[model samples]
Target: MSRALLARNGRRALPLIYGGRRGTDTLSGVHLAARRFIVDMSYSAHFMDFKGSSIASSMKKLVVTKLSPNFREAVSTQTVAVPTPGDADLLVRNRFVGINASDINYSAGRYDPSVKPPFDAGFEGIGEVVGLGLSASSRYTVGDTVAYFGSGAFAEYTVVPAKEAVPVPAVKPEFLTLLVSGATAYIALKRLGDLAKGETVLVTAAAGGTGQFAVQFAKQAGCHVIGTCSTNEKAGFLKSIGCDRPINYTAEDLAKTLKKEYPQGIDVVYESVGGSVLELAVNSLANKGRLIVIGFISGYQSASGIPPFKGGTLPVKLLQKSASIRGFFLPHFLGDYREAMSSMIQMFAKGQLVCEVDFGDLAEEGKFVGLDAVFRAVDYMYAGRNLGKVVVEVAPPSVSNSKL
Candidate 1:
């Protein structure tokens, strides 16, 4: 029998014939090609159990139809042939996929201009290894639960490089937070915050996903943790998570409160909000302070991509106080990924860390479930209606159950 291998990433189609020779080509960091089996017919044996059939042949996935601020309008679902993993890859049946504030930006072509429309969406996912290529079998076995960070995660299944997949203990959604949100906080604070005991660390949007981790990490570093949020409910949530001070910016002006309460100024600022809030963080820096900019969420849904900087300090104030602002883009800090993720996983398992996830299962306006719920989840996050990491359930327990 013959199987047709669909082309992806501009590569030509490569057909796989039973007991035939193999070929290979690489695209988007994954190898797509035919695999040669020692038993000649082991191909069906490797993939037949994916859905209790001889590989259903097709899968449903999300794709970016165009760039738009409206995430609901930017993406569309399509039924496509399941991708065959090359020797270095594992075909994963995605269970849950994590949502990020930057998803809208990616859809708007802000992350990579070279990428055109009709590209895959999503960055982090947790799944079970359903199929493995020859080389991947050495490191990963079918049914191994793994969490991966890459594009094309907004799908029922994702083909991830075995080297890039983190061997997880289970198919739980908490691990998804560690892959991206936890890593962002752990690495940024450890490397750039230069945190010290008794110092004051302020995390804006502290009730949100990555911000919550930043708050906890700062507290763990023996620093006095201060968190900023929009409402009293978020303030209470921050306090419950070890935040020494939870500033409700809406109840009182942020600048005035900082001047009154923290007259010495904030020692370190984990600034995510842009526009006026960013300016306030910059102006409130203490002597030798450092502000780590993980993202400008305020501008993510805007047309300009990034809000115009209006810091009064500019270069003169920073020079005088010896304060600095450092930007953190996770991809640039790949070296620290393993260490950061390992520590986060251990801490979470031991109950030393909390992984808050808003599965979008309970929404006042509407409930979210299944792949179709991604749009509502994105809208919920942008509306600041979510208190923690947002995620969408791609497949239920029946389909995502791992042998482990």
Candidate 2:
């Protein structure tokens, strides 16, 4: 019988053990052995049960106590009652949470001004379903792994709508990238950029979370990809990811290099870093070229939150070459999420794409663990220290494997 079943029927099962020949009253030996077996079985049952469920009454989650340009000062961890799932929600035990450049922007109330203080502080998380609501049970079961996009992902447990959560093969960090980073790149380039074969593409912040996917996708689309980064290490990463030209902008003057190397101008630009870098991309756009603006990380930390560009000549520049600029925000493209996420996940599983995750574990300063480590992870991202998708480990899986 299974250990769970044996544990449940321990009392009835104990009497069945034979002591002496048949009806011997000296049952001490059999009783002792049965008791030990029952104890072991019951413990195993409890361990397995807890893995699919939780008995804790409360959990810790990061909350934005106030609006601040500095991410470290804006959020604080607070213990609150574990939220019960709504009829259409699933309670997930978060394993790992993805970090993004906009984390600081959200903290500064840049996304929504009406959202007051003390709000949830995260965007996406990958975890196992620990509890299913009445209607959610129809689609999800306990122990099923899912990656979800919702508020409050920085918590140990988060309640996500059944419709928003995408089931994955396993609860791995690679799947987390598909939720936001991968989706943004795939959807933006496919829908807006209109990438074509033989096109010359430029990706700013190319080694960043979303930029990595952008570089690979541009290459897969048969385009010549030029990736820009601040350091040689990131430039090397861009080369490994199929970038035709890995420009370490700090080492070489970006404008001079682009002007000399590609006087014909770039066909498409996936520009993220703002300020002077954005100007460079616009100046280098070819006739009928398209520049997709995904983010402006260079100004995300500034007091003004994304500073305005000087010499407001964007219209003149675009008109000069018949070029256009488009902005991409993930939420506006939610309708295409399932298809994009599925395709990325399939490509990832087939080894056609690389999903890099920086857990902040190998950092020489310290490792990221628990909610407390989120601050460090955010800093690591903005500092341009991370290689790929930066994620914070919230709660690790159970390690005990003792068998009775």
Candidate 3:
């Protein structure tokens, strides 16, 4: 029944318990104690499930073990001891973790300028609190389901400050319908775009994790939503979600279609795929239109770390139309989103927001499972195979029979 967990800045330390009794308080004695106690009781009782697992000294989580030094060769699975929570930290046992384009970019040494190699990977995930530091806030209990957007998310366990954790609705927290994708979609459109009813909105890479939400929200706002995807199947999915027009870029010339079909120009352009797509989207803006730049996914894999745009008059065209482009980064807007996220959770819980999970197997055989499949999940997303949010199942919650 003894569990050992000691950590500092996400690094593991010696356990307070070694054998079934108080630790001997020495390095050699600690190892000797574990061997003495673990002979009969299998470690199985501790780690079978995230919610049920007792705190342990070591754990398994994804890390930047070796890098091609970039996202293309981003991360690898490694087994490392779990760390003790700081006085103000809560140790969370992860259930489902999210994969964003930034995760890949970070693998390539992109995100923060000061982070070094062999660092922990992941930014967003959901799980239950299992352990807490003495000074940690009492607002949450051990086993309370929580969602967060911060570091060390790709692991089986993560330590976060109490204030950072967001309580999920009693329903399962789908990354697609909540924090990362759904919230980003809701915030970008409502706060940044200030979308007007019946306005023409164009969404690029429209079938993606965030774009799908953008499309639905824009439609719900009474805007004419036009989505761009690479395939007929994706286009069809877009249509099913209320997109007014689905342009299959694989079969249609985007520029020509925009010119011939909507000469009035697009009112709000949600541009994520930059480079050529951004250039085209910029040229397609209506008077007083607003283009919200979420991410330049097109340049994520590039060494230059910048998505290239058409060379000339990019500024002049925007000026001529009284149009403007503003960048939207979700992290900056997270603090103000509690009310909006609560509303979004209500929408999903009541069956208003679509809840779809991808079961198709690409690199794996049938379905994605555990941390190994995250790389494949990212590849599938890059290949445009996923129709909704790409969520990685880390560990399922444990249900105990003990009556409260």
Candidate 4:
């Protein structure tokens, strides 16, 4: 191997070996073993069986190639060359990918598709580090399980920055659902909500992904947690997760129930479901209360205008009560990701936080389909068909039991 192919960590660059037969290295010309080696720099990879056949080559396992607004007709699959790793990137062999409402939104074209067509979908997942770039090191090693927050998580393989990958503790795969969702909730509550010990918190959509984490996080923070859910069963689930009181919004007036339950008002509002729920939450704020707006799932598909707040709401309440409302996005807080992740990992290690998964059982039941089936899954999520974090399992190449 040429000296140029060896990075600072002393590992030879795998990019040169993985690149196609015709490689270009205008950067430098290095001779080794009486032959010229060219380096190719690409940033993507594919999942193949241990036998070296692409897992997505068949129609049933076709890889996703494009996305559009309509889930029913916008997605397609195609065969593309696997990309090479960058100097600071690690190639991960994905085991299980966690699905979130954000994935559904992007698939349905609810947000701008940052990457053009022919790109994979998904934002969070757990994988094993299979290959590393020249500069990759002790932070991640091959065979170590890890979790990350970034795109391309839907596919069989993905490349991410060394810093974004965190080693998975000795926990079951189910625990990852909490780490991915809980980390975001923990950061939002700690940083934006300024949650304090013994405070009271009201969490909207308290049965969903972030809401579930918010409820547990608030309880762990020594706060009295009140969770609002759409159904009595969900209310029971919330209470089982440490909620002090579960409000069934479908049957009772939220503001009236809050007034009856808290009486003195709540200290913080973890608002994930906006629209009517948001307005009700604002009306139930306590003196000096802070409202943390994490997501607007209620408005994900609103064709009509946002509903007007009942009567005239005023910022005067903020001035009179010293209250405030804030919004948070996890990606924007990358600077504090390490602290947030560390806290969550400790919580998981101690069983202080729990995760719920609505496993599709696609692989076991033989219901698994190609990339095109993603749209149907999104529809199921939007229709509230899934009870918890919804996931579609992609069978790994090494597993041959037919049931994933």
Better of 2 and 3 by lDDT: 2
Name the candidate that leads on lDDT. 1
lDDT of each: 0.80, 0.80, 0.72, 0.63
Every model's TM-score: 0.87, 0.86, 0.82, 0.76
Q: Tens-digit lDDT track for model 4 on 329-393?
A: 77788777777766666666667777776655433333333334455556666666555566555
lDDT by residue (1-404, candidate 2, tens digit) is 33322221234323212122222112111111111221221221211123324436789999999899899889998999887677678778888999988888899998999999989999999888766554565555556677898888999999899877887767889989878899999999999999999999999888888999999999999999999888998888889889999999889988999999999999999988888788878889999999999998889889987756764888898899999999999999988877787678778867899988888876766778888889889988888888889999888774423110
lDDT of 1 by residue, 2-116 (tens): 2222222333323333333333211111222343332322333233234432356788888999898678889998899998887778888888999999888899988889999
Off by over 4 Å in 1: 1-48, 51-55, 399-404
Backbone clashes for every candidate come to: 0, 0, 6, 1
Candidate rank order under lDDT: 1, 2, 3, 4
Could you arrange the candidates by TM-score from highest to lowest? Answer: 1, 2, 3, 4
lDDT for predicted candidate 1 compared with the true structure: 0.80
Q: Return the lDDT, model 1, position 198.
A: 98
Query: Over 4 Å off in model 4, which ranges?
Result: 1-70, 104-118, 137-139, 170-172, 303-312, 361-373, 396-404
